[model samples]
Target: MYATFPDLLRLLFVPALAWAAYHDLRVRRVPNELWYPFAALGLALLAWEYVLVERTSLFLVRAAVSLLVIPLAYLFWFVGGFGGADFKAFCVVALLYPTYPSYYLADLALPLVRTQLGVFSVTVVTNAMLASLGYPLALGLRNALAGVVSKLMFVGRPVAVRQLAAAHGSLLETPEGFSRGGLDLDALRMYLRWRGVTLGRLLAQPERYRDPATVPAETNDPGDGSVTTEPIPDPASEPAPREDADEYDDPWGAARFLDDIDSTAYGTTPRKLREGLDVITSQERVWITPGVPFIVPLFVGLLLALTAGDLLFALMRLIGLV
Candidate 1:
């Protein structure tokens, strides 16, 4: 008979997956605070599943699954095929869902391979990988329908630089792996130097809120912390010549002119504004790479594995391959 998670176990595990997916989508990072606690709980639940439920045979099967899967997850991470969070997520999945969790529904149409293997986490991973194929395929189809080709190579269409920066996706590129709106590392370095702020400091304190206009550009060498530029200029006393364009400029618009020679004559522009200007100038158009958070696919995979069983197994059966 096929096995599944108990009701209590499902309740705990599903919510955790939902939370991880949300965090990964929003910030591209999941904090230790969320996963670490969930991991502890997962171990506890697995223990209970084995000891209290007295599913000794299932427990052994699950243990074997964990031994097989966790190392593979680690190997993916080690080989740079997986991100840190994605790797940890898989590890957690191995512990929490070593075998398919139970649902009190009629058995779904499953293939002979799955019935023979009966490893829950393996089916979930396979299903998620299969589901993920839809994203790029859809993007390619859209590009084909739109009559767009050449630079994007039918993987993605050229999008405006501003739009690309404001949105999120894997940036597309030519065969040479270059795109118009993609960040120009060399140009970015020069911009960062002129502003006298290092990327390290900016990242170290990303949460600090600052008015884009008011952030003072660094006058010190980020390399050795020595004075490299003049002190912050004051516009009140030595007013920089205002351009006619400044009259129509909003805060973001004003940022475009921050690098203007005359504007910096009176005062240093804000660091934040400088950064925005750098990004805007980085590229005119970009090929958005087709990538999605792996967690998203994994979450979908988990649900399908619970409701439908192994996708590849079912497909094989449908095609009379197994």
Candidate 2:
């Protein structure tokens, strides 16, 4: 009649993951502090579960699952497929629900399906990956409706250069042709703010700054040298350029800016800035793919794993392969 401890812990994941998904969507970053309490609780649950089972076969299964899931999480992060936050999340999931938890609502059993592996965290991740497959299909449909036909349409959309500063994605098209490593827009916005000039102004007078050699450097930087959380201003609101503005022969010192800001944080380098600037100055519209954060699908996957069970496993079973 009453919910078990594990079931109660499973329910707690709803709010925790929901908040994490919301945070990741709002800003690509998730605070490390958010995982601490959940991780601690998971460890406590793990210890309790361990003591309860001791040297039983169930304990061995849990231990084996833990060993597998933790390294898999680390591997995902090491290979850059998963973010640090995602890695930590998976670790917590492994500790909290190494095996699928059983729950029921009256006569109905929660998670209508179960897999032979019974690794709950793996189910959540696999489900997340399956859910993410929908994004490309949606992008392809939208692009097709707009009369844009290209293989690239499945992964990216065209955005105007004027909107680039305010955009969320990386550029797929560049002066060097198509590049898998898209230009980082956050770094571009940071560069703009550092110069006290809007993207419109820069684009309109590209000759004045395109070379980077002639762009003027500030005598004293205005900001506290931290990346600002403020929204990038719309290019439409950009002030008109002064007619009497003097051209500088000195270099823009973009590398200096990158160095000062610890460029690794933004995933940008001087070469990338130069290439991105070339594309921006030369093109009116560029293709970009606004990457969907994995956490969004991970949240969906967690919900599905708790309800309908492993989507991949279900599909395999349906196809008579599992």
The number of the candidate with the highest lDDT is: 2
Q: Model 1: C-alpha RMSD to truth? A: 11.5
Error (Å) of candidate 1 at residue 29 is 2.5
Quote the positional error of residue 112 for candidate 1 in Å. Answer: 12
Give the root-mean-square deviation of each candidate in angstroms.
Answer: 11.5, 4.6
Query: Candidate 2, TM-score vs. the true structure?
Result: 0.84
Q: Can you tell me which runs of candidate 2 are displaced by over 4 Å?
A: 53-57, 211-252
* TM-score, one value per model: 0.62, 0.84
Per residue, candidate 2 scores C-alpha lDDT tens digits across 87-198 of 8887777777777778878887868788887777788878988999998999999999999998799999988999876576677866779886867776677777666666
| lDDT, residue 15, model 1 | 71
Residue-wise C-alpha lDDT for candidate 1, range 1-322, written one tens digit per residue: 3444454454566777888888777655576666676677767777787787757886687668765777898898776465678888887777766655554435643322354576677888898899988876777778878787664544556677544323444344433445533332222333344344444433333222112342333322212111223342222321222333333223322344345323231222444343444444445665655335688899988778777788898898899898
